[model samples]
Target: MAWFSDAYHFEKSQLTVAHVTDCHLFKDQSGEYFGVNTAEYFARCLAAIAEHQVDCVVFGGDLTQDHSRDSYQLFAKLIADSPLLCPVFWLPGNHDELQEYHAIAGPHILSHKRITFQGGQLLLANSKGATPAGWVKQAHLEELSKGVDDTPSVVFCHHNPLPINGYLDKHLLENGPQLLNALVNTHHCIALFHGHVHHDYKYAFRGLNIYATPASSIQFTKQTTQWQQEDLGPAFRLITLNFDDTHSVQLTTDVVWLNG
Candidate 1:
């Protein structure tokens, strides 16, 4: 449902984002991930996102798995062919190639690392470190500090800041605490949303709220200590944002699971 306060506030102060992630698409159109068709699954995700009427869409990362240039192009093609009309923003994942993402020419896709709204600023930080584990560069940290002004804000990245399980935790963001202390916790960030863990999770770290979104392509079994995959339904997140009397933003987020 849309936010309602007064008509003007309702119209101007509300923002809804469709957060999708971890498609893991390969170069070939028929490529599948352990029997799951990543491209088809991504198409389903785009259709699901279209239903939300979001102001914008954020592809939280892991856009490709094979690390091929063609894979990234196919991702762009899928977005161009999808029903989503809102601006699309993305960041690179551990499996993605940075140069190809920078070279992509498309519609609706934005090169913006930061977007400002009447409610607050939305900062997209690149957490693609040297390894599978996440690390934000010194420059990104500087951007995060500058973008996160006195205005209330939210953060998006490709890596989870906290450990989730034995298998997933093995690749957890290497300097997660440093990231939290430097930008997320120190600034006026209400919540930090991420997707590398591939499970729906919520955590409170030093009074900051961090949320993880399930993958648009697949979900690893969350209860496992070892690596395991569930052929379960895929899901995305619908984040609704509204500003309060003090100009601080309040967000209501729900996970939308796609039908099998």
Candidate 2:
């Protein structure tokens, strides 16, 4: 609805990004899906976001257990109650329905989008498709390459392009190599961010930073080909970006654990 209000105070020259992922929120807090209180956990994560107070918030998809329209409405209302400076940006995960999300979030909720903020650019690529794992279709790749063609950019999506050290990696973006190739060949992306791994991880891909934020509901421990679920509590990533003409860009990622 583009409800701009004095409540949203933002500094035009710089931006702070808060990233939360894999909420898997449900309608009922007591509803146990995979043995986690999805709704309560998501509420706690939202509270954490309210406390951090960043310029913009990014939800790395799988926002709901199932792609329910009611779920999206609930999410919109939850975020609307927050006083964040910038509008929330959403990327679809394997669990989201792109059409429903667009209907709920608005026309701006495209599968992929290029956003400019504080002299820097962000390219959000949609990885939602019919694939059981992940898919970066040709059209989205082309669109992403175009967005990063000559700008310093950070990429966002739902699937990790790098190895996650588990069976889940099998569902990793099947076409990640092609996507990364497009990014590297285009010379525009400085970093790539994603979810679905449900853990905090960082790796270097073709000289670009590839990072994954932990789930906001529950975290999965890192193991070598082993699946271990832990009550690591809810987590989020608060990232501050500093840019200047003479100095290399500076970035910091802080893990914030929700208390409750």
For TM-score, the strongest prediction is: 1
- lDDT per model vs. reference: 0.81, 0.72
Tens-digit lDDT string for candidate 1 (1-260): 01111111123577898889999999998999988899998988887788778888888999888988899888888888888888888877888776788788466777676666677757777898889999977666766766676867788989988787647788888888888887654568889999988879998788888999999887888867787887777789999888878777889999998867
Backbone clash count, each prediction separately = 0, 0
lDDT of 1: 0.81
Q: How would you encode candidate 2's per-residue C-alpha lDDT over 1-260 as one tens digit per residue?
A: 11111123334546688888888866553655578887767767777776776767778989778667777766666666544435677778888876766766642222325556555666677787687588877876877776676766778889988777865787889888888888888876778888998888888878888888889776667875677777778888888776677533457787787644
Model 2 scores worst on lDDT over the 10 consecutive residues at: 1-10
**Runs off by more than 4 Å, candidate 2:** 1-11, 82-85, 106-112
lDDT for model 2, please: 0.72
The TM-scores, one per candidate, come to 0.92, 0.87
Candidate 2 local lDDT, residue 249: 47
